[model samples]
Target: MVQRRYSGRMDERFEIFLACAPGLETTLVGEAKAAGFGPLRPDAGGVAFDGGWPDVWRANLVLRGAARVLARIGGFPAVHLAQLDKRARKFPWGEVLRPDQGVRVEAISRKSRIYHGGAARERVERAISETLGAPVSDDGVRLLVRIEENLVSFSVDTSGEPLHRRGHKEEVGKAPMRETLAAMFLRECGYTGEEPVIDPMCGSGTFVLEAAEIAMGLLPGRTRRFDFERLASFDAAAWEAMKRGAARRETGLLFRGYDRDAGAVRMAGANAQRAGVDGTAVFACQPVSALERPEGEPGLVIVNPPWGARIGKPGPLHALHRSLGDVLKERFRGWRVGLVTPEAGLARATGLPFLPPGPPVAHGSLKIRLYRTNPL
Candidate 1:
């Protein structure tokens, strides 16, 4: 198959933001820098870097824990609705949206004259349809217009559904972590596919499966469609090439997950199979105490133990953390450990020396923090 080449040159980069879980911006930025995409600047919800459309697509395909990819199309001064309408009409809508396809407009206004978001959306929608011949839809082309002070900035949601919905997880547990967030947390935990990855209290195999996928070189978006596919300038041929050029293979990286519940083990296996990594993940119905060190050496051991908010009573959770800490300290040496917990006290229960915590990630309504110990 002929692979498609993105129109822009390799050096042509756009301002790309790596959206991460709250408090995870610096960590995600560090991951991007470690992966050599740097000169990263920390932003409100993510890290901002400059890259081309290819980088954008690659970020979508490879980034494990981003919420959404947004493109800063342009910004301008707009003190009134007329200026907003005229600017919206003149802005290159044709370059972003197809005339035949529909789009949905959403907006937020701060201390600006155009205070009505609905009015802004309607004006932008009208400009796209009347001036650019694009059809209008309710849910497509999520146009986010921000009016702060007298400046109006427009951004488009390049990632259609959040990257968390990798499209393979059909079944979700009561309090399932988003695949994107899980991946980011794993990265924050220092997972580099060079070490052993273990999710002891695997709820549904999210961490293990994501690790397997990364080790295998499978593009997370390989089986998924992006909103860019519906854009006017979307290059179907280039996308096909990128897709066909993807490398999928097995590796020696040992990924293991153990859940005390049998049903969770089954679900993890099923999710792995769905994600095309069933053969790679080692799933067990045993408890965390049974988790063994990878054959060769100690690497990165990461876990998302149960959070009390999702599982109800806190008694079992504390016991679970204590046991997990004991097991790690007793069995695994020379391995870096990472724990995700809703309560700092729960993490403290593990009796592990932890670094200062990062910002909390939104796991449902409860905020979860990632705690890491030194590289043992």
Candidate 2:
């Protein structure tokens, strides 16, 4: 499903799908429900809902846990490529894209007779190009066509760049967590911006920054320009008004981050500044053992320590985990703890009372599991 991030006097209703990290569907659905959405059902890495263009715009702008927002264009039975072509030709491509704007088509076929994906794409491209006089290309205004079990569906991408690039992080450290992943991890930990949040191993300050932004009620897409602006019905005035509304809301302080590496600490500071959350977030350069719990009542402490794959050998890293757990138990008994790691054995060595670990979230080849502990 391609993201539909447009606004205007067109259709008031659409089928919107939210893409999320695996094992986080329940979390995302909960978020949507809390945000006054749903009757949502669980699906692979996403939650589907019915809404209009306003909801679509709002989702991309405010959703902290979604990877992307796809709008369903149309779907139909396609026994062969010709059927796909006919259905695609009848679609309202002209409403979304201008004749001067170039379009790209991508197709995938499975469990059906229409196996030639390249040929299917070509047919779709020709249909739109010849019928609507819209030019076709390998780039720009991507229209993703998915064919499975002899069924064909079409959608236009409304999010030009992936939602992860929130235009905030100018400098990122090695193995830095993406902003979306950071937000999702924080949500999984039941963060609601009321208490002080700490990230002891905050490489590049992603987790800390996301927490700060959430506390402030800042729209994640405010600082960045979206591809939706280029669509046919984009209401610049409304979008600007929405941006102003978000900016007018003052952001609060409920977040801090610490990294033992001075270089990472400095990078985190720079990223925070770029993200406009520097004033609300505090970054400290100190070892995990020396890092003190936030000076308040019981809050939340989330960490992303360097596993053996990114920075060090398993022996030293295991010792680090043990030291972290020891410090948490000794100094911060009332605080909840959430840990993100690639190794379950090492996570267990932390000695935290985490339940069954979460399913793996794909970060390239490295699948990570999130483990959490109760606030004792």
Best by lDDT: 2
lDDT, candidate 1, 1-376, per-residue tens: 1111233344555567777767778667766776567687889888888776767777787667668888666667888899888887777676666777778888899888889988987888888889978777876778788888978777778898888899898876767878887888777776767777888878788888888888888878889888878876577787788788877876977688888889888888888889988878878899777877778877777887777776767998888889889988888878888888879989999988889987777666788888998865
TM-scores vs. true structure, each candidate: 0.91, 0.92
Candidate 2, clashing residue pairs?
3-158
Off by over 4 Å in 1: 1-14, 34-38
Decoy 2 TM-score against native: 0.92
Task: List the global CA lDDT of all models.
Answer: 0.79, 0.80
Clashes per model (N, Cα, C within 3 A)? 9, 1
Report the error of model 2 at residue 129, Å: 2.2
TM-score of candidate 1 versus the correct structure, residues matched by position: 0.91
Encode model 2's per-residue lDDT on 176-266: one tens digit a residue: 8888888888888888877778898888898898888888777788888665666665678877776777653464445788887898889
Runs off by more than 4 Å, candidate 2: 1-11, 247-254
